[model samples]
Target: MIASPDDVLDALDPEQRQVAEAVDGAVCVLAGAGTGKTRAITHRIAYGVLTGAMQPTQTLAVTFTARAAGEMRGRLRDLGVPGVQARTFHAAALRQLHYFWPKVFAGPPPQLVETKIALVRDAVQHCRLRADRTELRDITSEIEWSKATQTAPDDYPRALLEAGRKPPREAAEIAHVYAAYEKIKSGQGRMDFEDVLLLTIGLLDDRPEVREAVQAQYRHFTVDEYQDVNPLQQRLLDLWADRARSLCVVGDASQTIYSFTGATPAYLLGFRRRHPGARLVELVRDYRSTPQVVGLANRLLAHATGEAAKHRLELISQRGEGPDPRFVEHSDEQAEAESTAKQIRKLIDDGVRPAEIAVLFRTNSQSESYEQALADQSVAYLLKGAERFFERPEVRQAMGFLRAHAISSGSDPEPAHLPAEVRAVLGNTGWSAEPPAGSGQAREKWESVAALLRLAEEFAVKWPDATLRDFTVELAERANAQHAPTVEGVTLASLHAAKGLEWDAVFLVGLNEGMMPIAYADTAAKIEEERRLLYVGVTRAREHLTLSWALSRTPGGRGRNPSRFLDGLRGTGSARPDAFRSPGAGRGPDGTVRPRRKVGPVRCRVCAKALQDAAERKIGRCLDCPSDVDAYLFEQLHQWRLERATEHSQPAFVIFTDATLTAIAEVRPLNERQLAAIPGVSRTKLERFGDDVLALCAGHELAIESDPDEFEGVPEPEIVPDGA
Candidate 1:
């Protein structure tokens, strides 16, 4: 019996139904957060198969992450469309290679080799090169990220080189390592994981007959998170797109954060360019978050620097509200963490699930303080999206030993424990970095790898008859090895890991000046990236988004100020937390963050110097001079400024403006540079007797920190790209 069209329609919301039934041609389901774009795509696949519009084997659904691919497949299976190969690009490539390998390689494909850190150490020792442990560790990490992103050595830019990343030592060096590593493996006849995709793509491209045969097998396609297509992956997608009009895609351009790994949003943004007459559908209602959350997201994008946010279609939320968002300011880091812990504990007591909450921060390093706090509270929580499964010390070691046994044998060792697929991947990156001799720390280094082996051995003893599959399987068990507590609690994760995920409660911690938008956000492009991150953080909360900040790192120093993004939401009289605020702050009119007002200069009483530039300098006393202080020299003024900064834990230049310091050193300005020489004295200042500096000095000239070039007014945020 055929599933009725009405049944399919009933399966989807009205907005989702439009995408599901858009089967006549190319369709772009440009879904924003929380929209049922994934649902619509699933129903579309089910509809196509059930209605006899397409066969199960004829369709493909692709996603950014393997986890997402698994979710999509499960959804399809739930819909009774079991044959649809919803897959990650890599997985899809491997499938193709499995079928086409014989045609391209002329024999059973050579097993790919996995290289471990021990081997690198072996190579280093054999090469007699003296390397520091940190240097060795960084080299391994660099090679891993490079190979993951598929960046070749010659292609690495100058900046990367300066960052201390060297590629393979020599061109032939890595090739030799890889080739020898493979030779040893081929003798054992086992395949590496990446070899699957690399070999598969190689197969389809080399043999036309095989490529066509495989292409004919799957004719329709759907891709989720279409924006993150990398270079090599795009080529495989292009092959399928050639004869398929059943392709459907959904993604958001604003969350294009993986640009570092060669992921590009060009595919999503320029979809129409690829299929000129394609149908485009956008779902604006955000079913994933509360209206207040949605409101904040909208405003954040509205204020964000780039066209991505400024021109985005606002995501309206249908989720219900729960709590008034709070922006707490603490005195220091410990207080920030402790306060957040209190919120988490309270939420759990109120019956919120532990997994339902997330504590997001800017960087992984920031997780330490929160982890400590959570431990202190005896909270059981998981770090979001970490390689909790694969990269754990024990898990990697188990996989390492098995892969090593396979490698040492030079062919398929026919290991019973590892899954056939994982064994394929075991060829590349299976070891630890070795410590150099006499340089010290070799034992420590070897012990770490040994501990990993010990964990693996423990697993093997426990599961005597286990397969390679069991090794990867035990990862989650290993993660929960301590089984610390059974209570549901809060989650701790990075803002980057929180995308496409939702939490009932979210505490966005560390919203301080240097931590949120971050200090490096001086350039226009960087500022926009920071804004996008804030948008991501705000959208992750389904109910409450507690905007927070700390005043300082020291235990009781004046707290570091809130991020500028908090413009009005800190104390009372700011933008009120309301449905009207953009999805980020979603502050009500009253809660809107009022931008901070500038405090102009105060002339120095003893030296007649004005104060420092607000951002780059500090407020300091005049007589705390450096022993080398030359009141007449501007460079000497800088020295004095540094001396003061060292004493006060503030940056240099707080004592005086660079221009003022330069003027002082150049003219030894015992007096103003001919009245105009009063550094930073402008037309207004001059008209107002700016040269009164000498009078304020009482007798001697001291440097001031105020900005000399600040003009008549604060500029308004631009409303549009004038030309565009």
Candidate 2:
């Protein structure tokens, strides 16, 4: 009555067709980037539904990211398979946990505790942990593992030791702090993300009712990026697969880069041996990248060591010949950033969209100089996986104030109360956000408060008789407390966070040593992992990819070397990569010679911290010059400035910034009170620094308080003190 499954073969290429049509047994599609593996899976789901072999609700499709899930959903809908369930592993698990938690527990489920580095910091302080200035992220990762594997704090040291996770050689102290952390978390009544999956797996394993229900519900299961299934996710997937033979999967062992999160390709490699009758499919078509890029990818794979290199699948380049991959060397960070930005500008001038170009880096910290260089060049860019968005100074302050007020007033019965007050105050002061969109978990409780407030405004507009108090009262009642905004624009993601994502144009910036392979990659294994990370970044670009590294830190910090990966490619002048070096780079537009600038070290005048190469001089007397140039911005920015050519006295930015001085010269705040009212001028500082600021605003010379620190190394700052 229905055509054979081979009918689906019409849309896929030979390799893809086989993988897509192999519905009778376990299927494994091992392929390289752009080989249409994702497309084949999507089509296979569509065909199964169309052939009446699989119901939309019975099959499970998994992706690695929320973005990928959305994309898969759209693709399935386009192919007339709307009901197929497609989601990220974590997202799906969280959903199931929320649904089943109450039913199984017989009462309201224990709330997920939101773990923070604050807990680690408290531990560090409480336990007097004097680590070598370890970062919050590293600590968080350790805690993440402890919870993911369901190890109680009492058992963590033994469990982590067994799991090969080394930290703080002092187990007793770590145990003490970990115990304190648990006590604190129990008081808070929330759980970190890993615990959610672990809990889900527990419920499934401990309760047959829940396990059988889920197993029966998901008749078939498909997982993408199978190499990255963490232990908890693997456990859940195993349960689902226990009763159903319809487990189809796709992944390349070479792309297994998340070992830190406890994800390994061992399951993928062991798939066929474990399931003897599995229908294994291998697709080698390199459909996404040009031959040159593919060649480089292949070379890297060939050079790769360890498990991934050993299991590397051959990539058959199917795309046409493209530009060569380039290697650019820099003497320092500044030169590298400037050089890269200049090249991007040239590409833009030649009709490349800014969005089509991306600059990737090995870590988030590396983005600073490149972000500055791009900012210097007026290039708009997006950062990925950074808590930076939430860390905005203003947002932090507002949230802090709201959270404080909420705690004082009591957050129960409404977490929305304080945030609403803060937002109302901010909006009145000219912040125009209308809350985040979507019905995500956060929106359910708090974020919708803003939305409700918005609706209240609309209702008021329709019913003009309603007053502000009326709307405010109604808004509070409907307030949904915790909404994370649906942020848009370009993404600036970390190399690890950038996994499973594709972009039009990508920039991999900050390829410097200590940042890329990072300082710890001194080990052979870590170094190889770093190489795989770079390969991962390279593969993310659909059209354009820019890889760059800086030789030194920009003036404020100690200098670092250009990443070892970029060492040999360093040219003498301008440091432009030669043709055949990279597919996205290489030749400049219009056949013009891209200058290769030789880089030299430039040390900061203040702390002696190096700022890129010597040729990249400070922007007209170190923007950070400690000279009391009250008229200038970023007072501390002029740390290591040298060779001052002018004598102009004014207070530092605290006394009055150059921009404020310019505004003062233009708008001219005439008196003490008026100066106090100006933005950034605190009442205490305005009273104390009043005469000095007022005199400058009125274009008059005035005396200022002297500081011992102002002229630390130099005795000549008296030549022209700022706001004097």
Candidate 3:
């Protein structure tokens, strides 16, 4: 019983209805999270088709991912409208390229390269450079960024510098490698994924007939997640639309998290400026989370500072009151994982379905401990957005053959014979370079294997001396670094991947300072992005939300502080004294009284007075104590080290280990001459940080010391570790 298009408007709220009814001209919908934007857009398409405003075949609905496109098509079908041209930008471009390729020059367009990293590795080798797995990954990202931003190979270095991007490899070397990669790919008559768009654009520009055909076919267009539109995608979109202004785009600028891939919200944000007559609609009512969860999300947005913040639409919760969001603090990561699992179990017993819950983190790396904890508790779980196509079983098997041959070849390998070995491996696996006649899982697998062989050719050129063992090691490292396979159960995903998704209950685990804000987020802009990421995670919950963090990564390790994002939500600048209690302070599982460890306000070692400042308490010293010599200088040095580490994208310990800082504090070196003599103060470091270090020490020396009144009301001193 599919509903007719006329009745589709009934499904939308007033604001959504307004968006859905707009079927003509340029339209921009600034839809906030959980605002029923998907429903509105789908209904708009259905309505337009039913009312004869546009034929189903005349409309092109574009989304960011294949999954998203499938969802849109499904929703449109449910609304009694089908045959709409819904596809990803890449898919749409590829279709046009295929149709127009034979007319231009070639028998067939070069097959799309599926595994880009392998080809990039070949590119690096062609330039006679060696790169580890990490470096290779970085190079791949740089290449993607270069393509998305439309930077030419020769102009990449200057472009990267202008954009303030820091590539792992030298810019000039990357440019050379990119040039070599392009030549090889062209020589082989193949193109990578990005090349699909580049080729399509070129084909349309060079030949007007194809461009006219595409524009005539897709007379009306609608784009989802328009905020994430990259320049390349935008160019294709413009060519397809052909200034008809019949495009309806919907997105939230606040959710623009793909800037790393050159996606920008500028297109979405400046829709009116681009098309002055464009109609605008705003969606703010959140149909997802309860009032309490929405309130916290609003608070998160309140802290955001940027163009997104300026246009931010504070979500108005439509649901009734529910559970207050929980903030739990644990002693370490293991405890956090265990406690999260226990909560999930309790929720299941309380009648929440396992599928209704999700545990989101800032990074995929944080999923391992949670996966273990869930398994230990006999809980069924799933990992969404984790299984990459290249990491699939059949794909990995094909890559394995190439890796084995590469490792066995070692130094002085025969380049001409490598293709034969690759062919032999493919033959053994019942695969061929030509894809199966139709599209399905089997054809996709064959394409993946073909891509691997292409990578092998590149590798042969780059590392003729490399062995199969070396390739295998690199592949294993890559496999280890990849996210787990997606399965059906409780969901686990990174905060980024969790966007455009929702769950009845969400557990945002590992909310510590370094993990949430991530030490690399040194700039004010980067921190804002982190804050936006947290907001994205928060809004993903429809009912219950639990934010938890560990004091340390491991038991008996140095303590960690809660994320600063938790400050306003908790109504405190720091964690409350009772926020995190030791395991011994609470009752055991059997309800027996557990013995407690000594817990109270931390007192200074010299004066025995409760330390008021948290920093002072952590340092375990009173301001007037003799051991506090040059404490100010040490604090300044630590701050400087943190800033320097952020600039260099290194850990604070790497710049100046904690032990080195302590020694400096104790010695209070007054000059570069003395600073150079200190252990851990390498000559290079002295040249870099010596002036600032000595100046701070001199400033501290000018401060009045040895206050006689400091000991007036103090008890006998207790021995404690320096800076405890």
Candidate 4:
């Protein structure tokens, strides 16, 4: 804690001090990663309070996450300013709604539904819709995006079209489900997280007295992570600061990567435009990472295009030089996981704490192999953004049964006997010696129990004479601490979860094309966002950084290329700094070193014009170009797809969307090779439905697929109940 209010200025950098001292007007701070944005903002708020420029009780600081709000509150308290209100948008809105509901008309505020998945399921049933787990999650995500963007159910289809979005299901279906979900919620007198903000906005907008009361209470407002603000949140913020007496927003446009959830940098980027007299501050001094890591991060942004790129901050490292970021290429995912675990083991052996290291990937499914590999190396790890290992149902059951057995034994066991005893106890809780076949809930459950078993093995190795009771006691202490060893373990998280976090050594694995940019990021904006995602990942490393990709998902599969983002940054003869290069960079798929070629814009097949639209490029022609598609063939394929969907108990689009069918009809492919050229014809789908699709195209009877296991199920979107 600072000794006095004046001392706050002493802790800030020149630019940060500028932000802190300018407490009188609308301030827009373009804070880069690791630039002490939080530190600067907190000091500004505290200084405003201690110096008597603003009342702490009247000032409100709103952030996107509860964790961020807590951190802000903690900082403000440490600075000797504690009366300020710091909360998430939902939390703040909920409090206001609860307070004003009785005054407005209601007996009490409606019950808050934390998870919308259950309600969504009910709505799906009401709509007579069918969706699997993945589809449900996708639907839930889409609905969340819709609400965040303030798109109504009736306007959802148009919004999807306008946004150029490829929804999991048809837009009409989703809109129907959304409408049904809302009706159900209203009937139950319940509100979702989005409704919390929506209802609050309604109260403020429609009721002038209520609006005046809120505006009077919170005269000064500070918003953190302004780049991630959506339309709904921005609207609520506007209501809170109706007059804009004093508002300070801090964010980086380059870090605005949550567009899928409807988060945009528009608010932050246009802040000055909204307030012409606003004081703009750019904080580029990065204190978290070393010069080398910072350099790589800047290089990534250098290649980025679009509006976000125009405002991209070139971060300057305050720290001294560190290890150059390493780029590793592996033969397969298994080998990549093993090699990564080996590297992490070496780092741990070399004295880096497990908690200081993180292995981040593009998705959650990528974590399983790494989990197994890390366990093989006896390395402690924790999955971020996932259920706590000890809190898992299987783990809790295992722990309970283990405690019972320990109480009944009434005898001490040698350290070597501990692992076996723990495994036996876990076995009673349906834990198997071998893991399940696939990566699903069953596998996740097994991993949790398996992690416990691994912990026991390590514990025994450390304590030679420990008993089962001692083990349980240690486990209890660890669980209470919220970590395996004093809440310390290597973090395994997705790239999205690793934001706002820094690690001493970061391993960014699975940088393959489809995973990094993601196969679904077909549009220019989405691709640019993917680039920003990598930029965020690169900036997360404080010192050692390893960026790696695997050629194949499994051994002996077709080799794949590294992420396009790494094209100029990896391999020999690359344009990256010499310090960051390995011996053999820019290797082709055949393992031969090749000169890099600049990929030109994709030109249309019919006309030699550069194609811009993703859909146009996908089919190798402009939308306005003449089509060579066989109309009869297209209809036949469509009918066959519909029949196949019914036979498989799946949606028609699951087999192949209309776009893919059209592309196929246009190409009139005679062989599997040509069919594989189509965009949505996944290798798995090709193998399962390829023969049938080809048969239909060739004017032959469709082959019946008898084996259900051979079905490559493509999930259609549906809502996952909130909190599930």
Please report the candidate that would top TM-score against the real structure.
4
- The reply for model 1, stretches above 4 Å from the true place, is 112-151, 158-195, 385-483, 518-527, 557-559, 568-724
How far residue 165's Cα lies from its native spot in candidate 4, in Å, is: 1.5
Off by over 4 Å in 3: 1-5, 387-488, 572-582, 585-724
Model 3 lDDT, residue 199, Cα: 93
470-525: candidate 4 lDDT, tens digit per residue: 67865664454343232466899988899999999999999999778876677899
lDDT of 2 by residue, 1-724 (tens): 2234445557788888877766656887787777888788988887788877788898889977888888889988877778888998878888888889889876755676565667667666776765322333445556666665556778977876665555534556666667776667667666667766777888888999999999888888888988877766777788777887487889988887777667778888888887788888887887777666665566656667887778787777776666556565443454565567667756766877766666776554444445444433434556666544234344344344444544464424433333345456556533456422221122222322333333433333323333333334333221211111222324556777877767656667777776667654545766777878877887776655556653334322244565665543345222336333212222257863333222233333344453321111222123354533443212222321111101111113323333434333322456654453333343334533466555543432222224435434322221111121
Candidate 3 C-alpha lDDT tens digits along 578-615: 33333433345795433333234445556777554323
Task: Show model 2 residue runs off by greater than 4 Å.
Answer: 1-8, 115-137, 150-155, 158-171, 183-190, 387-492, 503-513, 543-724
What is the number of backbone collisions in each predicted candidate, taken in the order shown?
71, 65, 9, 12
**What is every candidate's alpha-carbon RMSD to the true fold?**
23.5, 17.9, 21.3, 24.3
Q: For candidate 1, write residues 537-638 as lDDT tens digits.
A: 887788877876765653323435778777744343322532221111222358534222222333332344543322111122133432222343434445
Each candidate structure's TM-score, on Cα atoms with residue i matched to residue i, is 0.61, 0.63, 0.67, 0.68
Stretch of 10 with least lDDT, candidate 3 = 715-724
Ranking of predictions according to lDDT: 4, 3, 1, 2
Residue 345 Cα positional deviation in candidate 1, in Å, after optimal superposition: 1.8
